[model samples]
Target: MEMSRALDISAAGMDAQSMRLRVIAENLANQDTTGSAPGADPYRRKTITFAETMDRGTGQPEVQVKQIGQDMSDFTTRYEPSHPAADAQGYVKLPNVNNFVELMDMREAERSYSANLNVMQVTRSMLTRTIDLLR
Candidate 1:
């Protein structure tokens, strides 16, 4: 029963990290995305927040996605007079998504996901060995 709870917690952690990875990917993909019209705002970077909650059935704290929200940071501007989204001052607003930051976040999320997967695998192995001992 404890092994089952471990599996559940690991699964929840994996799920949360997967969502984080997805959000990071989206930010990376839209790093160069600009608005179609002049003076329009570009795509804002999205951020994922996680929270731990007790699973009533298992009485274990599991990770969950608390929010997927936009980054409030200011967008970078580039001098591109010919661009369609250029403002009156010949400056184009770029998305707030930073490739370096996104990559770092992605790496962290991947590592977390891998760790959770390892935990699940170990738990499964233990359960298997316990069953073998009974047989």
Candidate 2:
């Protein structure tokens, strides 16, 4: 049952990372999205938080999405006089999502997800072998 637990844990981790990746993609997609009308807030980056919780039935610590929160950091301002969302000073509010940072986060999430998937696959193979040996 330990192997099964390992597989379950890894599967849960993969699921959590997948969700994180999705949120990151959304942030990237909306990076240039400014306020529809003037004097409105620009798009903010969404944040994903993960938590490890005990699965009561399995007594295993599994990863879960704790929160999908908003980044409170200040938005960047660019002097774009022609932009519709420009302020009185001809400064436009830009989303807080930075391409470099988002790319790095995406890479990390992808690695974690791959590792978890590898773990689950290995566990499944081991279980299969054990069953074959018994028979």
Candidate 3:
């Protein structure tokens, strides 16, 4: 019973980290995405927040996605007169997503996910061994 609870908690953590990874991937994929029209804003970076909630059945704290929100940081501007998104001043607004930051976030998310997976595997193995001992 405790092992099952552990498995459930780890699964929840893995799910949250997976969502974080997805958000990071989207940010990376849209790093170069600029606005389609002049003076239009480019893609804004997305951020994932996690919260712990009590699972009613298990009475355990489980990680959950709190929100997928936009980053309010100012977008970088590039001087590109010929670009379609260029403004009157020949400056184009770029997405706020930074590749380096996204990569770092991705690495952290991957580690969290891996750790949760490891926990789940260990819990499952222990449960299996316990069942075997009884038989």
Candidate 4:
């Protein structure tokens, strides 16, 4: 029973990491996105936050996505006087997202997911062995 519960916990962690990775991918995909119309705001990078909560019915602690939030960092500015979205000062505000940073975050999320998976797998194997030994 304990082993099964451990598996559930690890599985939940894997799910959370998967969600984080998805958000990172989306941020990377829109890194170059800019304002479509003149004098418009460009894309803003988003981030994910996780929280742990107790399952009311099951009385188990589980991980959950707290929120999908904006980065809140200042936009990057570049000079592009000819650009349609450029401001009166000939500068355009770009998304604060950095592709390299997103990639690094993705790798970290992947490793965390993999570690949770390993935990689940090992727990399953141990449970199976215990059952066999009792036979």
Q: TM per model?
A: 0.98, 0.95, 0.98, 0.92
Residue range 4-101, candidate 1, lDDT tens digits: 99999999999999999999989989999999999899999999999989999988999999999999999999999999999999999999998889
* Deviation of model 3 at 135, angstroms: 1.1
lDDT of 1 at 19: 92
lDDT of each: 0.94, 0.92, 0.94, 0.87
What are the root-mean-square deviations of the candidates from the true structure over C-alphas?
A: 0.7, 1.0, 0.7, 1.4
In candidate 3, which residue pairs clash? none
Clashes of 3: 0
lDDT of 4 by residue, 1-135 (tens): 678778878988998998998899888888888897656778889889999988775678989899999988888879999998888888888988998889998999999998999998899899889999999
TM-score of 1: 0.98
The 10-residue segment with the lowest total lDDT in model 1: 97-106
Minimum summed lDDT over a 10-residue window in model 3 is located at: 1-10
lDDT for residue 53 in candidate 4, whole number 0-100 = 88
- In model 1, what are the clashing residue pairs, if there are any? none
